[model samples]
Target: MVVLFVVAASVFGLSSEGVRDAVDDVGPLAPLVFIAFSAALTVACVPGPLLAGAAGLLFGTALGTPTAIASATLGATAAALISRRFGASALDELSGRRVTALQDWIAARGFLAVLYARILPAVPYNLVNYAAGLTRVPLAVFAAATAVGCAPRAFAYVALGGSLDDLGSPEAIVAFSVLIGMALVGLLFAARDVRAARAARREG
Candidate 1:
């Protein structure tokens, strides 16, 4: 779905300026439309970073941060719920004792589990959503964790997007620096967590 959208956008010569113009033309309904579009695209596996950047490009950091956060929260919740409902049996079939233990741990600390996953650069947003669905974590807990955990990266990218046209400017440079820093921190944590998970699996 995302690939198709990208292809269509490319084929049609759709640029950020075009998207910005269209979003602006929508006037008062722009925020709602943007949220809806963001959620849908995200659920379809569109890259969250791209969407966050686009939000910044379209609405600037002040509005884009919250907009991206809200959209991502909504999208993650929607995917989790849908996967839980439709894929429960498949998930059960795939689950082993080790998987069950992990699920139990997540269930016991669902919010933190989701928060950790959301902040991990190596973990894809959609994959976390689907994986969380297989756990006993409540939707509200998952959504809350996603909102808080996603904020920093979302803000950084949005800030970068807001300053895209002036990359040499102080604000743009700062935003870019912050974005790289966030990615590095996230990647480090992600690598650590992957190692821990692997070790636990071997011990099991």
Candidate 2:
């Protein structure tokens, strides 16, 4: 693992400009090459946002958004499967009511559950990737939910990165608006849930 990371780092470099240059040098195959590296690096714990930002810098918003989404979904799916296979087994041995409850909740709600978590801004993306594997949610459902739920933010983030040098650009404006809108929506959902929970407690 360490050797692989070192090799990739040497080949791609750690800077936005460097990775962009290296991948771009691949000519027509650049997007595929970027996707491969992005997926591998993400599995190694590299932040998805960094990759998405790099995508925008490398390919602009239109191309970068889809590229980032594919890379993130592929990588996140891999990480979740890894955790499910290894981590889930270990969790199974430990056994706790809380664990069961979480697993069941995720399993029962399936796509929507994963979707809601993915849509929420404060939720950590990478953590969800690994943790989802431990639950009973089907693999296909997890991947689909991840792609759909994350698409909006992926576009917004890519646009933001692409517009770093030109914040006045239309892409930047749309990106900022989407991000803020998502944040507000997440807050509203959180408040509603809180109220519901409080009401339930009172009734109980």
C-alpha lDDT values of all predictions: 0.81, 0.81
lDDT of 2 by residue, 1-204 (tens): 222433444465454355567656778777788899999987898977767777876777878999999998998899999999888888978979988988897799999999988978788888899989988899999999999988988888787666655667888889879888998988888889899999999999
Tens-place lDDT per residue, model 1, 1-204, is: 223434544676655566678778879778778899999997898888788877877887788889989998999899998889988778779989998888888899989889988776667788998888888999999999999999887887676666665557776677667767877888888778789999999999
TM-score of every prediction relative to native:
0.81, 0.86
lDDT of 2: 0.81
Top-scoring candidate (TM-score): 2
**Model 2 clash tally?**
0
Q: For model 1, name the residue pairs that clash.
A: none
| TM value for model 1 | 0.81
- Find the 10 residues in a row with the least total lDDT in model 1: 1-10
Tell me the deviation in Å of residue 171 in model 2.
1.0
Candidate 1 regions with alpha-carbon error over 4 angstroms: 1-22, 187-204
**lDDT (C-alpha) at residue 32 in model 1:** 77
